[model samples]
Target: MEDKNIFDMLENTDDELMEDFTGLCPEIDDEKFEKLFAKSEEDYKTRKAEIKRAEERYNTEGDNSVRGVERIRRPEWLRPVMMAASFVLIAGVVIGSTAMLRKDKWMTGAGTSVPEAETEDTTEEISETTEEPETAAATEEEKTVIDGSEVENITISTRWRDTVDEKIRAADDLVTMQQGFISMDYNDFIEFAADPSLDWNGPLPSDMRESEKDKIYYIRVKDEAAESIADLRTKMKDSYTDNYLDNLKDFYNNNRYYTDWAGSGFDDLNEGDMTDKTYIFLEYRGKLYVNSYVKSCAVSSGLGDSPLIIANETDTSFTAFLPHVTPNVFDYNDVSSDEPMVEIDDMYCEEVKFVLDPECNDWRIDSRIPHDSGVFGELYNRAAEE
Candidate 1:
């Protein structure tokens, strides 16, 4: 019986041996087959243990099959769902990674995509808004008339009227003589003319030798005053007279002789044509004289009294008075026929000096002498002789 079973087991194929052993063998009966096929508790435990052992062996040797043959079994019904879930999870992970890469690319390109042209325009606009406005230079459009000529070509000196105007404008103030008058003393005028700082082009009234040239200075002042004589008188009344007198005295005492009485009167004169008051006049001898001659008011009312002095040169006293002559009171052409005068022997004097007697009340001698002396020694001598 042992020999027959051995021969039969040896002769049977794999499937056939499994089938015959299951069907006919009494020792390996239906109960045993059922236990193997239907998973009894012990069978189940054994199967689990075998699966565990197989997994351990597979982990260790990289093989999980009987006799090195692969086992084939039908998958469970839920296997497809699990596979689909796994596929979905893998696809989600790949999609999320791709989205992150795209975001990084966008962030990296931000700086390179900015428009340089817009930035430049913005900078230029800001710069232009912060810049200063351009100022127009002085030109012919700003030229003023003087001596019948449009004074376009101006050479500024410290004594020049235009230069004084410029300086006063720069300082935001009005241009009054340091002595507060239209003119200064002969020496003061000379010093002022000689100073490179003073803007001067021609000779001053006191320096003019030719009567015609001398008349220009007077005419200039008269014209200037005519334009704004009312305003000038107002200014004189307000503060110019006091300021001018003090400044004139100081300038005269410091730079020139104290005998320069003409400087004192120059700033004190009022040039109007409607009042019969004392008039301050400039002498050709560069001396200041107060004329008692009456004249019309050339300016407006309420424009306080002109700065006229009532004292002669010998008195050394000063008394304030009102307008006594017109704006152009002493016409340059007027000269007396019989007038006593003195001749100066000193060439260094540049002009002659006339000392009238204390009783002589003629102020024209003073006016004519200083006025002509400024221009020519001959005219100065003639006036001095008169």
Candidate 2:
């Protein structure tokens, strides 16, 4: 038989091959056996042609066809299996080729990749080659650390002590005493006593001795538009005295204010002398002294009884004044010890005038002397002598 005829007969045959000849005829009982066989032969020829074309492309473009060469070698009987396998194999080859082409994008190497070769040629054309390592020198500035704590000391100016003394004296002179009228112009006092130079750093003298205490009482002027300073003082005094009397009644009832002294002599004295009295004092001995004159003045002025009294006792050499005589209590603790003691610098109209003893250490003026004063008169006098 002719070679072409023999090949055609072999391609058309459906007879099952023995296990030994499995390589020659792969499909044992396939329904499309003839078609599969024909397709296999045609695929092999197409692959062979592809290999030749790829080899030519490789030579011309400096690419490779080793993968395409590998796909064509798989057997004819195993064509279905080989075709599926070839798809995976071809994909792997394409991926590998792409990676090789992009190798310089990801890796630094001794051998030139396509992109690197092109970059080298472009640089050569530009005539701007990078300098060699031995010839190159760094031009960066060195970092520095600075010490900023060595600046010069600044000088501050201060006022003389005599200037402050004069201001206090001027405030004292503003007091006026008349029949049924005891008043002080606070505005005039503040104006004269305003000393810009006074150094406010020393401790103030606490509740003063009776003799040194300012006898002139100050009344805060409440009217915002009152033109005369004297009118302001009168209004402040009237308001203060009215509130004082009301608080006194509350105190005598063994109420909130005087309740602190309940079991003491203050309790019994409140029952007798407090009746029909505008001002009552709890003396050092704890006896209540009722003032009838102040009561009459309070009634005529339409002001309530004075809740507190200011008394100068000869034995103690101290002036006693009750706080909260007005509706609001003037808190001595709120006042700074560093500030001038007698000067009413706070504009809040909250301070009640008190005469503080230099030797007194009372935390509250009514109580025993404050603990900070060293043994009261004893240590203080000795220190003064020294």
Candidate 3:
């Protein structure tokens, strides 16, 4: 073929012309070219088959089936032909600079050329990025060390989690607990129990007000109740992903307690710390622990009807929006009860994405996007705009 025809064919992107480039390839001995071309074609077919199998495994078995595969070593002669074609394409690009500039950008951090001696290293580098399946997983399984013992990587079973409905239910379970519902405890789910005693104290308000008299008081959680509280904290850490857990801890660390100047607040004032800042003393078994904030005996009244709606679902992840009405919070001194605290209404609730954890085969909260309503949300949105 003529040089001009080669450039014209490449520029036009004629599919048939592009496919059989062996016609334009440099002349070589007939027998040597046939042998090399046949070998390379076989290698290409094998690589394609391996990649297809890997994708199938990934869909059925999750990420574990995506283990690295040993890339087939490309024949040496094939590289020269590819390089020649690349040069031809570059020449065409020079002739069609306007189209090239419009459609393509230079590769970032790409070096000019590789020495012939370093060709093998360059081939290996390219293979590493290739998605073609390798045979590594058959010989040895990936391992992780837990508690000083090596364990082979295993995927979570799809027995109980085969359906989309099941995944949605699991997401609801996590979101329900994350919203601080008092109905269920973490001990009911996770194996680990709460710490027996923790001498942690919350900061106190700058000054105690008369209105906080009945509102701010410490409740002594002893025996089973104290253990339950500790277990809840432990389970919360396990349930949430790193970001949400950090936010929860930051809220706890920033919270300040309020105490009355007249001393005794709750029923057993002596049992609770009466320092400048109030502290709730929890007695787990026989030991005592202090906490900054604890949920009081208040009913968790809400809009009642709310369901977790999942969106953008895939084999590995999904976005869930739990729409529920926010409960109206009454002040410490608000004695007049009028329309009631909760009403059956709809609002943007917790927005979170649940991702399938390939390691354990269970669903975990990947991320939480805060979607609040009422006064707090308005203030937050306004501030964000500013």
Candidate 4:
């Protein structure tokens, strides 16, 4: 055969180049190359026959045919793998040396890298304050807090509370005699409710003058209240997330109480301990326990439509005075719990108090207790005619 350029031969169509291809692969040696081809042919025939036999067996025996021949079942990847191995074997022999296909850039003149110096621009270290950066990564938006900014108050001490204890006990005893509304004796409740202190102050207020805004005193906050509300909200969220209690979750979800008080004006101040200036203009609900400031007694709750009242004391704290009641029960010289009592339209009415906290920025409900006997009856009766 006449010598031919290998590059020209490679440029020809594969079919033409492959025709008598063994004639070009002399490095593989004729004997070894022929042996490989024969082996490949034998493998192809064996695989084809096995598949034919399996198909016939399946036709005859259905699903059970697979059990008849495990050895003859060809692995799926075997053909591709064998083809690849045969290709590599032929290429290795034809190429004469593996280095023709091997990459040894580290050991070769062809693999040398350009030896340029790494130049850094030393003009200045651009300060963030002076220059813009190439990439401005987007920051995650901050989540808006669910807050109403409320400060709760709970009255823990008052001189009149002690003076009212005997009335509460006597009223409770009288109610126990009455049918249906029998509260456990004040004695029985002594385990939970401690008796008021003996440090006697003045009597509970009496007369209609206390309820009238013209006669009573009040204080207002223009800016500190808003700041206190913000503090309260942050604290509440921190507390809620820390505990993650379900009831706290409910409290966290409800924004009504704070919303209700947002525009509500100054609170009435009565005669009491007015020692601390910070305690003035403290913040929520009626002086009594078990009340909702957001909704009327009977509006959302299927109960009495009792209106709210606020009674403040000059010495320290306040109470809610019934608007309709002419006499202030607290003012009377010898006021019984029953004298202040009034039956409301509903049986389930309650009262809540937001007494001044030590910080005096917000009011909080540390805890609440329902008025007993005469007091309870008065609150009930005092619910508005609605």
TM-score of 4: 0.16
Clashing pairs in 3: 69-133, 69-134, 70-134, 156-361, 194-230, 194-231
Give lDDT for model 2.
Answer: 0.28
Q: List TM-score per model, in order.
A: 0.14, 0.13, 0.31, 0.16
The whole-model lDDT of each prediction reads 0.29, 0.28, 0.38, 0.29
Instruction: Encode model 3's per-residue lDDT on 143-192: one tens digit a residue.
Output: 33222433232222232233333443333332222233333231211011
User: How many clashes does each candidate structure show, in the order listed?
Assistant: 41, 14, 6, 46
Give the winner by lDDT.
3
User: Candidate 4 local accuracy as lDDT?
Assistant: 0.29
* lDDT for model 1: 0.29
Highest-scoring model, TM-score: 3
lDDT of 4 by residue, 79-146 (tens): 89978976775565445333432332233444455233311111122213121121122111111111
Q: Lowest-lDDT window of 10 residues in candidate 1?
A: 344-353
Q: What is the descending TM-score order?
A: 3, 4, 1, 2
lDDT (tens digit, per residue) of candidate 1 on 1-386: 98898877655354435666677656767877887777677777886786566435433332221123223444697789977975776566556545654554475563455467755654454334312111112233344332243322222112222322232222111221222244332222110111223222222223122332211122123323323434444443332333343453443333221222122223333332112111123342333232111011121121011111121223321211112111111211111101112111111111111123244331111111122222222222222223
Q: What is candidate 4's CA lDDT for residue 261?
A: 17
Better of 1 and 2 by TM-score: 1
Compose the digit string of candidate 2's lDDT tens values, residues 32-130: 877788899999898778656643442332212111212224466798886787677656655654555456345555364547677675445333322
Candidate 3 TM-score over all chains jointly: 0.31
Runs of candidate 1 with Cα error greater than 4 angstroms are 1-233, 236-241, 253-386
